[model samples]
Target: MNAVEIQTHARKLYDAHGTKALAEAAQMVRELEQRGEKKLVEDWRRIQSALQQMRGPNVS
Candidate 1:
């Protein structure tokens, strides 16, 4: 899949599974980085950062 597709899938997974999905997404992103897919890796990072922001200070 393309970067956008990967990102979309990651977001869906994150929404469905929460923190476990985030961890899996991170691993997927790392694998993409290892494979030299920089754009996809960056997209995943963006998704991850967005998720973090959503959690804010109230999250434990």
Candidate 2:
């Protein structure tokens, strides 16, 4: 998925699963790497981190 799609999907997953969405988002970013799309990997990583942070530190 592109950056926009990744962010959108990540948000949805986050809403449903809370901080667990970080791992799933990371997994998705890795899949994008395997597909050889390096351009947006960093963007997705940042998004994942932000999502995790927004969920708060106590979240697992």
Candidate 3:
């Protein structure tokens, strides 16, 4: 597929599963935090923020 088509399909998949992926990642962050992995938690939060931004401005 062309670049545009690939990007289109990727966005479609992300739109369908982005929230679920974020939730699962957040859960992992929580578990790590509970175990006192503060550094990892911060790293994961950065990843989560990037994903949220990609979802758009209106997202929480």
Candidate 4:
């Protein structure tokens, strides 16, 4: 997916699942990696990164 698509998906996911969206993306990455789906893994990684950015910086 392109950057716009990735951001859109991340937003929808965050809206639907809140904090769990990141975990869902991470799980997708791991499962895709184990399945040897390089392209999907890459996409999921991008999505995961977008999700992380959505969370903003962590505060102590």
lDDT of 4: 0.93
Off by over 4 Å in 2: 1-10
Q: Please report, in order, the local distance difference test score of every candidate based on alpha carbons.
A: 0.73, 0.75, 0.66, 0.93
Give the root-mean-square deviation of each candidate in angstroms: 3.8, 3.8, 7.8, 0.8
Backbone collision count in every prediction?
Answer: 0, 0, 0, 0
Question: For candidate 4, lDDT tens digit of each residue in 1-60?
Answer: 999999999999899999999999998889999999999899888998999999999999
Task: Tell me the tens digit of each residue's lDDT in model 1 across 1-60.
Answer: 555765676668778988787677688788999999997888787777656555566745
Give per-residue CA lDDT, model 3, range 1-60, as digits (tens). 444543454455457776685776578689999999987777666666656656677835
Ten-residue stretch with the least lDDT total in model 4: 40-49
lDDT of 3: 0.66
**Candidate order, TM-score descending:** 4, 1, 3, 2
Local error of candidate 4 at residue 32 (angstroms):
0.7
Which stretch of 10 consecutive residues in model 1 shows the poorest summed lDDT? Answer: 51-60
* Per-prediction TM-score to the true structure, in the order listed: 0.66, 0.61, 0.62, 0.93
- Residue 21 alpha-carbon offset, candidate 4, angstroms: 0.8
Better of 2 and 4 by lDDT: 4
The lDDT-based order of candidates, best leading, equals: 4, 2, 1, 3
lDDT of model 1 at position 11: 67
